[model samples]
Target: MGKVSTFSPAQQAENTSSKIVVALERLSEAFRVLLWQEATQYGLSPIQIQVLTFLLHYPEEKRTVTSLALYFNMTKATISDAVKSLEQKNYLVRKPSETDTRSHSLHLLKEGRAIAKKVEHFAAPLQDAVATSPLKEQGVLLDQLMQLIYQLNQEEVITHQPMCFNCQHYTEKKGNYCTLLKISLKQANLRVDCPSFETRED
Candidate 1:
């Protein structure tokens, strides 16, 4: 004889959802460890490496300490310390903003760029695993992940950074448009950390 277990459909669905949440959490922690391991090789902290990589991808306008603090959900003092350490290592340069003389913008130096390039490949394993899926499946997964990120931001559980879909300047019709810049945006051009991003009020 075999023991039988019974549960309602809703309870079964809840159990499955709980497992999914746990799996996502474990995956997130694994990626963090991978980043930390790569950072150590460059003699940098994880936050410094993150800032360098961010500056490499984003424009100078978004390289301010305040922006980094917001993106990382870190305090200004913590970001300032990381920026100062990077400056002392000659991996980054601080320049006074032309638009705002009181504020400084971060620029990655040659060494910083090199480090960013190296760290960028730290997620190769994850990428390769995702690549094994069909292209359409990959796209579906990305959309699902982005939706979760957007929801978390909306809930204020995470710091709200710039995303094209939620920006006041963004519009969708025949194609994506940036009303501020008056430019047509391609799907690939939708940025996660756009410099001109302004949150659209609901």
Candidate 2:
């Protein structure tokens, strides 16, 4: 008789989760490309659109590069590059941070604000369409997604610790990187065995 092939319950769960991630990633990328193309009609890149959108809802109307980097989980250099480009295009302005001289606060200029407002206005119908859904359903979906994200993060911590520890870009700063990321490093170490972990260039 041929040997029976069977996967443990854990193995089946892992396989299902992996497939879901791939599907979600592809869907996200497709939407992102579509959104970027839409932004081009207003002469804005996806990043610029995000920045402007953030600014519209930001209580302070501005943020430091460090703050933005942390919010976006990005590197300082990348944020600086984006800020410089926006400044040159008159879409953003940089001012000295009162709290930290070394760090500068970024503010959208009048032109930038105007453009952002336009984008927001243009997106109203789409936003309204999404908002029309029942709040309970939206909340349920949000909770489910949050739980899945937490599970994935826990798995990553278990599977990717050693790889993260050896990465040159890993910093030990508090509330910033490394240390915070290390809180779940054990699971991450178990998640992936890849040795190379470089910060995103963007």
Candidate 3:
């Protein structure tokens, strides 16, 4: 019988690390696919459904395409296309921003609101089902996950530069803001430090 050469300690460690990374990626990808499938079965594309759901909670804010693009880490062209399609489908309306002549805002139409409510109602049961774990264990797990997220976000804030230091969208005054947005410039600048920040074309 021929004896096989076993992996060295460093090689074994590398293999273990690589396996962990791949497993994590696979798990993430599976979750994404499952979520996408659920959204699609509800007769809405994932992005459309997300936009609809977001607008329901913050109906007063007529968000611009640029803002949505930045928030979603989506391309300007993709946002523009989605906005156009939604507008054509009568799910949303594009109107000129009252404050900024150069920008436009998205408003969900009445029909869009109705559809969003229906979709959200349908998904609530699934959400509940997925979260119906033992209370004590669930609480502990959630708390730990929240702590992990907070730590990760804190690390991001320390590592990333704030937009206030570079982006023209930021202003120094207590409540100064871009003409297009209702939010304070300081808050907008703070968003740059977010781990999720994505650039948008103005």
Candidate 4:
């Protein structure tokens, strides 16, 4: 072979990791397709829909334009444009941040919350497929995915995921433990996106 490439069928035939990477890429495309379908129905761009959906559940700490930009791997200007559009549509409002006078945070309006709730299920097809798997398998998959996300964050391939693995509250003595809650965690109890996550210092 000339080289080992993910796109090479010959390599993928032998490399399990390459195949998994290809599968993940395909799943990402599915996400985009589902998002676009919902976006068009609501007369919103895909990014705008994502912003509203994220704001609906995440806390105020992660609701600023800079935070959104970093989370989505987009520029601040792009997030600002989307936020402005949402404001004009009365979907959300920008309030002065309690922590930062110069910076403001976003809050979804009544209409915005409604839209986010509706569009959040756009990937129900994907979830429904995974839901058919055995609960034990689901638990294993979740653990594996969480580990992958943690590694990706370590490599700076992704940014600020707010997950349990990198959380200050998390530790593994015999099993997963939450220092903040003083509770032992099962695989099912682990959070991939935890609202209460505080970044652990190295």
Candidate 5:
């Protein structure tokens, strides 16, 4: 067998950011491969599985095709196809929107919910590895990732999604709060993908 090469940070002294790029690419590819394997067991595409998982976690109002397209950074047509596939498989159901009878909202069926639960844990290996790290280190890693995502959104490199910290509705005074919802926010309650997120003007 051919020898596998590893990334060498020492050789990338001239451009340290190259190492981060390589690491991120490798992590993304690894996760995609693992997700694909898990998706195939249910005879579903990765995007379809992702939709089901999103519906499982998000409220019904946020499960519209338009919202999903924006969240996944895919075109509406592509998201429509995936939704149709899931519907045909009886993994998802559509109900007419209460506010707009012409539009529909997606909901996962029992089978879809089961698959979502399974796929959700498909990254247990990665999670287990992270679990071995010190808590402070883990927090640092999460914060750094969140910052990177925030930067990407700011740059418009990816479609904007609901993140409490980046939303106009978010307020920080004596404590974190949501001005629109008039609710206090806990650190753990900070949503990474809020349905009601409105971008704050710079």
Candidate 6:
């Protein structure tokens, strides 16, 4: 039963999990294609566009090359190269880090915000498709996705995720509860990224 391979036609056919994994891989491919199309329009690499998009929403503390490298699971050199290109294109600036004077944090410029807004919609099609699903079905899918992501984060497969399931406030008491928020969370209430997240190592 342990011998399952999503890439193998026979195994994927026999195993529902394998088939779902294959579907996820296809979705990832779709994401890459969308990112490429958006990047090409602005003469930016996919990673550069991603960096701009991320910097647009994230706070300054999380906008450093090191943090970006970790979040994207890419090498520091790769993220730095992307940052350099963005800087050269007048899209962002590097300000000295408030915490570490020797280090720097990314600041998205006005032009970068405009470009990021355009490129960030690269995944709008996927969102629209998901929006078409029944409300309950979307909630179920969100639960499945968040649990999978939480497991991946626990195993260190996904390096950085500030999700509800991994937050200090999270609990399984009477079906998902937030100790800090003092609220019970349903599958639909689960958060993929919560700004108030405080990491809990358990």
Pick by TM-score: which candidate is best? 6
lDDT of 2 by residue, 23-124 (tens): 677667766766677588887677667777666666452377665665555677877787787788898888887777776677889988888787765455
Alpha carbon deviation, residue 4, candidate 3 (Å): 21
Q: Is candidate 4 or candidate 5 better by lDDT?
A: 4
RMSD values, in order shown:
5.8, 11.9, 10.4, 1.7, 5.4, 1.8
Candidate 1 pairs with clashing backbones: none
TM-score of each: 0.79, 0.59, 0.55, 0.92, 0.80, 0.94
In angstroms, how far off is 75's CA in candidate 1? 1.3
In model 3, what are the clashing residue pairs, if there are any?
none
Q: Candidate 2, residue 149: CA error in Å? A: 3.3
The residue ranges of model 5 lying beyond 4 angstroms of the native Cα positions read: 1-13, 169-191, 194-198
lDDT of 1 by residue, 14-56 (tens): 5876566767977888888888888888888988888888888
Name the better of 4 and 5 by TM-score: 4
Global fold similarity of model 6 (TM-score): 0.94
Q: Model 4, range 1-202, lDDT digits (tens) per residue? A: 3667897898899999999999999999999999999999999999998899899888887799998998898999999999999999999999997777999989998999988898888889999999999888898889999999989989999887888899999998858999998899888789987777899999
Per lDDT, the best of the predicted structures is 4
Better of 2 and 4 by TM-score: 4
Instruction: List where candidate 3 sits over 4 angstroms from the true fold.
Output: 1-27, 121-126, 134-136, 150-202
Per-model lDDT: 0.81, 0.59, 0.59, 0.90, 0.82, 0.89
lDDT for model 6: 0.89
**Higher-lDDT candidate of 1 and 4:** 4
**Preferred candidate (TM-score higher): 1 or 2:** 1
User: Candidate 4 deviates by what RMSD?
Assistant: 1.7
By summed lDDT, the worst window of 10 consecutive residues in model 1 runs over 3-12
